[model samples]
Target: MSSQPAIIVSSLDMDRIEALIEKMPRLTPEVEQLENELDRATIVAPEAIPANVVTMNSTVRFKFIGDDKVFEKTLVYPHDLKHDEQVSIFAPVGSALLGLAVGQSLNWPMPNSQSRTVEILEVLYQPERAGEYLR
Candidate 1:
């Protein structure tokens, strides 16, 4: 995999994600990747996060590199994931999407033994921006 761009995450989200990681007896690669990303992240206070940065409960719009298909999902905690519109932080795509800004793209690993690229088209709603920091 190519080098990932530097990313920022909120301190609250970081704490919650770390606790989640600790609860798992075994870590999947996708979850491990999320842990690693958090380790290297520029952690900031909830109110300090930029409006465009993806945070927990943020609604993101993105598209695959070659496909014309676009998708919008809310990044959520594992427990909050209820349907296709929500993406759990434990998933590979969810891990890749966190902290990404509009226009940033991540080359994500897939179960099919191939890499797929997804570019952030917009951050439709971010918790920090909406003043829903504690959510």
Candidate 2:
């Protein structure tokens, strides 16, 4: 897994964060508070969607400039990438890819006022909600 900064999330792309949040073991009040702080730094990644978008750890695969492209591979998360796609846990687009759904777009700035858009065409898999659909 790349030490780069990115987001690691499961399912519910562009919707709910509770899926991954609920997976985390319950913690004490102090830990809970710290967890809140952690959320701020960590990005939330979403499941992969063929011909649309997929995020591993920090690495992100999406359609851009009218074509499919992979951005910031250094953030790929360690361990098996449960789905067919791989996302670096720490990448520019990985963190931003989470909590998003198809047809939605983000105009993120890339230094200066220059910015680009990321349009979600589809959400292929969301393990928590996918069920047999995953097969």
Candidate 3:
């Protein structure tokens, strides 16, 4: 995988993610990846986030590079995940998707010591864009 592209995360989301990380029982590779992302993130006020950027609770459309199949999923915290369509922030793909803007791509690490390129095609809904900063 190449160097990661720039990412922007909302301050509120960053705070919540940090708290969640603090409660984890152990540091998994996924957790470490998330921490790396958090460390490099450009944080902005919730209202200042671009509408096309994926934020916590945002529903996004994305696809693996070179794949014709596109998928839509909602990025959610662990406790709020209730179905297959929702991805926890602790998940590798979910962590990779956080803060990515529409048209941006990242090389997502897999458990098998491989990586896949994932591109953000669209952000269908973002809580910050909807004025739901407290969510």
Candidate 4:
């Protein structure tokens, strides 16, 4: 029973993520969490997703609750993670960022058995927003 907020996902991103999950040799807890998120997500067409929503390859600015630090990341597939600014979707924080819209928040479960509240400050570069949906 997490207090995680509802999420929306693009159809194309969902399809790609599902295919990646099927290829995984083992399903870890983080991966399982991602599966759960996907299961509960409201799926929408890429063209239909709002420009403010986070999609694959979106550059997002967010911050943890109770922390004044703001972090930026570009959500990407595993293969595309070659830089510090890019976060792989397989990672826990990355999974938590998916589908969140500006001003929305998520409860990310930490490895220390605690949770951190992450709030989306803005979506600087959404694929759909820039007309780069094929990514």
User: So what's the TM-score on candidate 3?
Assistant: 0.96
lDDT of 3: 0.92
- Candidate 3 lDDT over residue span 46-134, tens digit each: 98999999999999999999889998999999999999999999988899999999999998787889888889999999998888999
Candidate models: Cα lDDT each: 0.88, 0.40, 0.92, 0.91
Tens digit of per-residue lDDT, candidate 2, span 28-115:
3433432342364334333333322333322333454455763332223334345545652222344445534545565443434455
Q: Write the per-residue lDDT of candidate 1 for residues 53-87, one digit (tens) a residue.
A: 99999999998899999999999998999999999
> What number of clashing residue pairs does each candidate have, in the order they appear?
0, 19, 0, 0
Worst ten-residue run, lDDT, model 3? Answer: 1-10
Residue-level lDDT tens digits of model 4 in 1-135:
456677899999999999999999999889999999899999999999998888899999999999999999999999999999999998888999999989999988767778888899999999898888897
lDDT of 2: 0.40
Relative to the unseen true structure, what is the Cα RMSD of model 3?
A: 1.3
Best first by lDDT, ranked: 3, 4, 1, 2
Per-prediction CA RMSD (Å): 1.4, 10.7, 1.3, 1.2
The superposed Cα distance between candidate 2 and the true structure at residue 6, in angstroms, equals 19
lDDT of 3 at 31: 93
lDDT: worst 10-residue window of model 4: 1-10
Which predicted model would earn the best lDDT?
3
What TM-score do all the candidates reach, one by one?
0.94, 0.39, 0.96, 0.95
Give candidate 3's total backbone clashes: 0
